[model samples]
Target: MKIVVQNLKTGKVFLADAPKPAVPDNGILVRTSASLISAGTDRAVVGLARKSTVGKALARPDLVRRVLRKVKNDGLWSAYKAVQNVIAEPKTLGYSLVGEVLAIGHRVEGVAVGDRVACAGAGHANHAEVAAIPSNLFVSVPQGVADEDAAYVTLGAIAMHGLRQANQQLGATVLVVGLGLVGQIMLQLCRAAGLKVIGLDLEEAKLDLARKNGVLIAAKPDDPGLAAKVAAATDGYGVDAVLLCAGSKDSGAPFEDVAGHCRDRARVVVVGDVKMDIPRNAYFKKELEILQSRSYGPGRYDPDYEERGRDYPIGYVRWTERRNMKAFMDLLASGALDMQVLTTHRFPVERAAEAYDLVIGKTPTFTVGIVLTYGPGEAEEYKPAPKARRKVPGKVGLGIIGAGNFAKGVLVPAMTGTGGFDVRGVVSARGLSAQAMKERIGAQYSDSDPGRVFDDADVDAVVIATRHDSHARYVV
Candidate 1:
């Protein structure tokens, strides 16, 4: 299968042919129809990945800390080689997509082959012709929701989860700090919930669009009298909730201005990359509470819930990620929200680089919703994955069965320095951990099943890096 992959070292985006991803017993394989490129998220990700080693270290101190620890444990040469291996790998992009299920796992329920569904997950639902979507990350697409529209489901659920963070009444007002795609969707959600919304953004076009779309008021953060204007919008009640959606570099999101005029006890829900430098005095006096909205909802980033399909009881956690997706789809079907309005460009999978140019500000044109369409793709222009990491064939192919910290930070780095072993695959109890390890270590593939590694022809040696409790089972 051909998929879009970015070189971590060069930040060069292109199409590469690789073996079709295996559908887990808990997942399904889908032929991708359409996928949405998230401008804010994707740009930030690719930008960081493309930077020089020093630049990457400077940008991420936590990673640097991990490297320092590895150096301390394994010596300098080992740590350096490990870092090289990480950046040499390709990265998969795109997390929101709509596709037709081509195959289903025996354990998957309430879905079957030929059904149209929206899939979410960084590695699982990629900018590829095909995606292996886990049960928890995909939802059935209702009738009337176009593939492109449904591709916006992940972002919509993110916006919905942000608004859900704020405990509000129907008549309460929310102040949205960023008016990009997520902020745009948040507007529709707030309106659908019968709440008044005030919007803030640097782009006049976006502010104008917000006004036309029924935002109670919209203004640039630097606009004179912005606080007073927000005060006027709510008839002096002030903002009841503040949803911060600005990017990481945007240190000047008008939150301070709005903070001074907000109602007592108003909640602040942070959903984006903005800095968290709150003034103690103002918040202390207002007795306001600050909260963070995890991406999507309760099931996100939880291996047990997302990979193993163990759902949080709806009675306890009513609006899980899947539920949020369903609600967003319902709103789309009811015509209360439209993703087409935000779409500024549509490109075939072949032209994804052009779409990303606009996303990262390399092209200065006003743009949003760069949708990539697929129609019987992989004809030409696909190159065999450069330096196939999946199998070394006659070489010393090593398979790793754990992705815990010790494996990634210590043992893996030590092995890379040996220079003879081709790290073929990695397994983790948690799907994301395995995927993350694969990206960092340039593995052929990642899966929760260690049997794929043990049973493969190319794997000449296996490392039992998992917990000791599971060692006897694998060894036997």
Candidate 2:
């Protein structure tokens, strides 16, 4: 099996082979159809990994201070060595995975083999051809839900859980700050809950998407007279609640616009980072209720509830995070929510690096959600080269189809370092990336059309790293 893993401290990802793992006790193995790259959470992790040694130390000065303390007290360099060891480890990427169950382990019940399931967790649920996830994290996909739609289960569950925490009533007005993927999901969920959704973002493209999707209003965060517009939309009563879903390096700062526009005693649930300072005067005047929503429900971060076999008290808290995923899938299966507009791109497994590059570079074109795909025979056992093409003697030629920064920084570097493979060619929709890759890696040729790479006689293996929408086509 081939999996994409990133070094936790280096933000470097490599496509490497791993043993086809067996289903362990309390877990189930699934063949992945699609997985959503959680932009904010995963990007935060990637960004942390990409930070320089000095930057990391600056960010976590306490760690450095602790090491200094050890140096002064015991003359021990162990803390420095420990930090280096911690930096050397690799972290698995992804949690929003939808796939079919291939096998089940001992003590795993309720879900059968061949069942379609949405799996979410840190290490067990990942972007790979196959994953072994704890049974507790696997939620059955309802009938009629497409694999791509089900890929949103984890994120949808997150939005839903946050909404639940807010506890808004029908016809209540709500503000969703930051219309990223999660925020957009919250918008849909809020609409489903019969609440008014006012979407906020800096990008007109994102706000445009929200408006097209039926959000009550979409506006820039810094638009002058924004409070008046929101007040007019809400009949001067202010919104009943606000869900903060913005992500930034320094997101802890209060969104002054939200504080200004919210009605007195309104509930505010924060799902993303924000500078968490409460102005006593503002709170005292408004009597606002502020809350923070965790990623999963009661089962979140609980080893016994999510990782081990122990089930929680179901009667009191009926919907665990897994159950929330089940509810999300049910909503999709019933046509209550549509995921068609959310998925922006797809890439095949071998070209995974290209997918990461797009996310890192923040390419404005053809971007929304990015998914990595793997076909039935895409494992290490089979090469992605054309079956009809004859193998070249002494040359392992590769055809790369994505040329984003991630490819430039990590995967391409790894490919260039491969002992036997020759960087034969690359392709992108536009010739710019292809040409740049040709120059950077000394590829023999480049083309804007993928067909050229597919037809090239010298290419022995084709690596797909395009968007999610393109994955099925490339795989087929």
Candidate 3:
């Protein structure tokens, strides 16, 4: 399988061939048809990866502190190797993908093989040929929703979760800042919830897009009469709630600006990455409430809920991440949310690097929701490369299941340095990582399916370097 990956150390993006991943007992293997490129989130990650080591350290002081703590607890060589592994590995990108279930684990239910579903989460739903997704992070895609549109389900769940945090009622007026992909989705959801929606952004084109999509009142953050516009839209009471969906390094100005436009005791929900330097006086005087919306919903980042498939009680937790995804798909099926208008570009998965260039504004055109398409036959069963005619004797044949940072920067280097191991193959959920590892180690084969490694007669040992939640399953 072929997938896109970014080198954290150099920020160079490229394609690689990897093995198909093994499905966990509570997960399913998906053959991706389409994946959504999140401009804000993914661009931020790429930009950080492109920065110098010092720049990265400065940007994430907390991470530096954590490294320091590791050095204090562990020896310097161990700490150094850890940091090296952290930056040297290639990272697979994309969190929103729609595909068919090629196979299901023994414990998986509700979704069967050949079922069309939308997957969420970071590593589990990456922009790869095949992804091993936890059962709770995916939802069945309705027949009416196209694969391209269904790819937006994860982002839609994010917007829906942010709205849920606001807890607004019908006929209330809400202000959605940003007007980007997530903000645009929030605007449509607000309208569907019967709230009068006002959209704001720095780009006139985005504001225009929002207006075309049922946002009657839209304005730029710098508009001198912005407060007055909100006042007029809300009959002088200002907006009942503010959804801050904008991504900025410093959110002080936007928050301060919106403070004057919010009614007394109004709620503010931040759905994007931004510095939250709230003005004490404004929030104190207005008695405003500020809340932060995590990605998706309640079950997000909970391993027991997502990986182990232990669902939350519906009575106590009405909307888990999976339920939110389902709701978004339901809206798509009911025609309440139209994702087609938000999509501006589509590229084949082979041209994924160019797609990222578009997202980063290297291209001459603009895009809001970019979808990466895959051919019908792109998800065929894995086939190992032909074996070498002559093989080295007495070398321990090794196959690694993940080619991520730890595997690439630490394990592979150590194995090759020892001069006693022959790396037969490298397998990663993303093909790019597998391909990169194969090139780095001069391995015979790289694949997206780990089963190839296990089945190989030459492979005497297997290494698992995946996430902690996946380690046990891989080990077993």
Candidate 4:
């Protein structure tokens, strides 16, 4: 099976051909039809891949500071390597995919062959043709829910869980920061719940799109008096809840802007990346309640609970994150909301590289939702990258798109073992990545253009470990 992976070093994209994953007894094998690219989480990932060593250190100054403190007790090189390894591991993109069940493992009941389902859990429900997903996280796709619509279920669930956390009543005023796909969906969900919604973002076009979708008030991120505008819209009382759906380099601190704008005792639900700085003055004065909205709710990050067969008692604790996914899908099936306008772009699996570049470039041409399509297939033999060097005596040609730390340290290094795959031509839009990868992997040539590497005859096979947006294009 071929999987799309990000090169942690150069931010170059690559396609890896590995053994087909075996289905666990509690999981099902899904032949994916469509997978959605989560731009926010993935964009942060691509940006990390483009950073230099100094930039990485600065990005994690807190970690660096902590490491410095530990280095006095531990060895300096040891702490640095530990941090490097943490950054070097490649991350899989896409947790939302709609696919047909090709096979089901024993103990997985209710689902059978040919059943269509939407899967959650990253890496398991990746942007690939086939995935092995645990039974508990898999939800059946109702006939009313189209494949494209079903692919967005996981994200919709995220918005749903945020709403549940906010506990807003009808006619309540709300604010959603970051009018990206997730924010936009939250706006619609808020509107459906009879809440007045205000959207915020840097892009006017996205604001305009949100306005069209029922957000009456859309404000720029840089507006000095933006919180005032939100307050004015709320009759000077402030919103009942503020949902943070934007991703940033800062720690996701809900006590900053939310504390000032929220009404006394108003709730703030954080769903995106933002730094959390608790100001005692504000909290003591207003008594604001800050809540973190986990992606999969209580089951999130619990390998034993979410991955293994250990579900919490349903009667005692209703609506786990997995249940939220079902609720969102059911809402879609019932026509309470629509996702057609949200999906903006579609690509086949082969054009995966272009998809990654689109996200990495942060292209303004098209911004909403993007989907990658895959046709049914078994383990297909990959034509070794054509441009890779096949006649280097014992060396082989390789093309890598992403040059992030993971690619540079692991994948690229793994490909360069003695008598193993030779690192040939490399492609990365970033000059630093291309140059750095060329040196580290001993590539015969390096180019900023992916086409140059793709078109090269010396390249044996392409290895794409770029961004989530590119997974579909390259696989096609």
Candidate 5:
């Protein structure tokens, strides 16, 4: 399999060959068909990563602090190299993808091989030939949805969660600040909920979709008379809620506009990366409430719920992440959301970098959404590469099977720091992560083949750090 990996330091993005990932008992192996590129989230990462070294350090003070700590512990040269390594860290991109289930875990139910499913997760639902998606992170695609449109599952869940945060009643009036992809989804969602929607953005072009999609009013956020428009649309009561869906470096981007146009006691739900510097005077008099919407919904960051498939009972939590995603799909199934209108560009997975160029404005084009298409993934085994082993006396040859965050950040570092083992090879579900870790630790080789390690007489021991359900299979 081939997967996309981006270099954080230089912003060099490329596709690299990797081994086919083993499916966890609580997950499924999916061969990706389509994936969505996020203008806000993915763009932020690429933009920040492409910044100068000083800019990168400034943007991430936590990394700066780490460098300082490293200086105190290791020598300056080693600290500098550590900083380089940190800057050069590779990240898997794309969180929303639709694919065909090539295989399913024994624990998986109500799903089978050959099912088309939409997957969501930072690393699990990536822009790759194949992804190992935990059951909770994916839902079967409906008959009505296409692979490209079904790829909107993650963003739709995000937009739906933002709407949920507002808690508006039918026919209630609301304002959506920023008519980007998520904002467009919000527009349709608000319409589906029978809510009166007002759309605001800096660019008039962005508001066109909102206007066409039944938004009562579409105008620039800075329009001096925007409050009057909102007032007229709401019958003089102003909007009942404001959903902030724009990302900006400006701390005070549209808060004043948001505050001035909102009805008294109206709530503000922030769904984007834009900073909030609520004008106390502008909003305090109204006694407005401020709410923050987390990504997707409940069960989002819960490892047990997502990775272990421990679903929250519907009786206790009405809308878990999976349920929210399902609602989005249901809307698509009911013909509420025209995913076609939302998608503007299509590129083969091979042109991923070019697609990103369009996203980052390097190509100077407007877009609501970009989809990366993939060919039917033909399963390929890991072909052994020529080996060069660092033979050291009295040292164990350690082969690792997982390159997840915990494994790379903790386990590998702990073992290597002991000066008693040579990291002979790495095998991970996502080959890109394994390759990165192998180069970082000076491993002899990296691939998706466990047999490379299991069959090698030089390998002294193996560490199984994959999902818990797969541990027994690894042991056997």
Candidate 6:
């Protein structure tokens, strides 16, 4: 299948052909129809990935420390090779996608083949032609919700998780910082829950979007009367909670502003990328509580819950990531959340690079929910054709899955220089990558299905250059 990947060393985005991922025992194989680009998070990752090694190390000193520890414990040569391997591999992007179930594993239940579902999580619900998503991360999309709108389910879940962290009651006023896509959804969700919502952002266009979506009180962070506006909105007590949903290079100013607007003993929930430099005096005097909202909810980053499909009991954990997705889908079905107004742009999967450009501000456009649409006939089961045997003497037939950075930069280049190996086929999850690699390598065929490589009779050996999590599955 075709997948979108970015070169960590160069930050160049491209498509690659990868073998079709196997359906796990506790998962379903989804044929992707639409996936939403999380502008804030996606841009941040892309930006960081594009930076130089030194810049990256400076930006993430914790990761540098980990690398240094590895060098200390292990040999420097091993650490160097490990870092080289990681940088050489192309990283797959995207987390939220809506698709139809092409197949299901034996342990999968509640969802079946042909079910229209929204999938979440970083690697599980990637921006690829097909994804092997655990049952817990897949939520059935209601008939009323369109696939394009359903793509927003993950982002909504993120916002929902942050709102839940605040734990504010009805009629309590809450301030939402950064009115981007997540913040906009958060504003609507807060309104649905009967909480008074006030929005703050640097972008007037986003603030305008919030106002159109029924958020009455909105202001810029630089406004001199911002504190007064929050005071008036909350009847002089200030906001009961502040949900910081904006991403900033330096979050000190935003943190200070949020602190200034917050009421005494109020809660501040951080959902976006912001510096956590809290002012001791302000926090001490107000006795405010600071909480960080994990990506989705309780099950986030828990292998037992997400991967093993073990759900938390309802009595203890009210909302897992799956429940958050369901709640967002329910809101969309019930017309409580206005996804239509929030969806500002749509791009075909072929032009995904251009879509990223727009999100990163290369194209000066106001966008909220940018959806990537796939071509028709993507939901069908794949069947690989039998490969013809190599007729040339002393030549070995080669079929490769995952034509990303490692395949193109190292593997393919090495194979090309080798004497007897013939490049028979190249497959990627992304059509662009498959086609690009095929043309560059002079391969006989290029496909989006990995089964093609496995079934080819001419192919003497198969190469797996995909992500670490997929290595074992591809080998099998």
lDDT tens per residue, model 5, 352-405: 989989878899988889999999755353444676666576999889998876
* Range of the 10 consecutive residues with the lowest summed lDDT in candidate 1: 380-389
- Candidates 1 and 3 compared: the better one by TM-score is 3
Give the top-scoring candidate (lDDT).
3
Off by over 4 Å in 3: 382-384, 398-416, 426-438, 446-476
lDDT of 6 by residue, 1-476 (tens): 66788888898877766656667778898899999999998898888887888899988899899889979997787667557756665788899999999889899888878889999999778888888888799899999899998999899999999999999998999899999989999999999999999999998999888888787688898899877777777788888999999987675667788888888999999899888888889989999999999989999999999988999999999999999999999999998888889888898887888988888888988988899888765443455644544635678888888877667765777777877788888877544466667776678777767888898878888888777777887775
Q: What is the Cα-based TM-score of model 5?
A: 0.90
TM-score of 4: 0.74
Best by TM-score: 3
Residue 217 lDDT in model 3? 86
The alpha-carbon lDDT assigned to residue 94 of candidate 5 equals 91
For model 5, give the 10-residue run with minimal summed lDDT: 376-385
**In order, what is each prediction's RMSD in angstroms?**
4.7, 12.4, 2.8, 9.8, 3.3, 4.5
lDDT, candidate 2, residue 211? 96
Which pairs of residues collide in candidate 5? none
TM-scores of the candidates in the order shown = 0.84, 0.76, 0.91, 0.74, 0.90, 0.84
Per-residue lDDT of candidate 3, residues 231-272 (tens digit): 788889989999999997754677887999899999999899
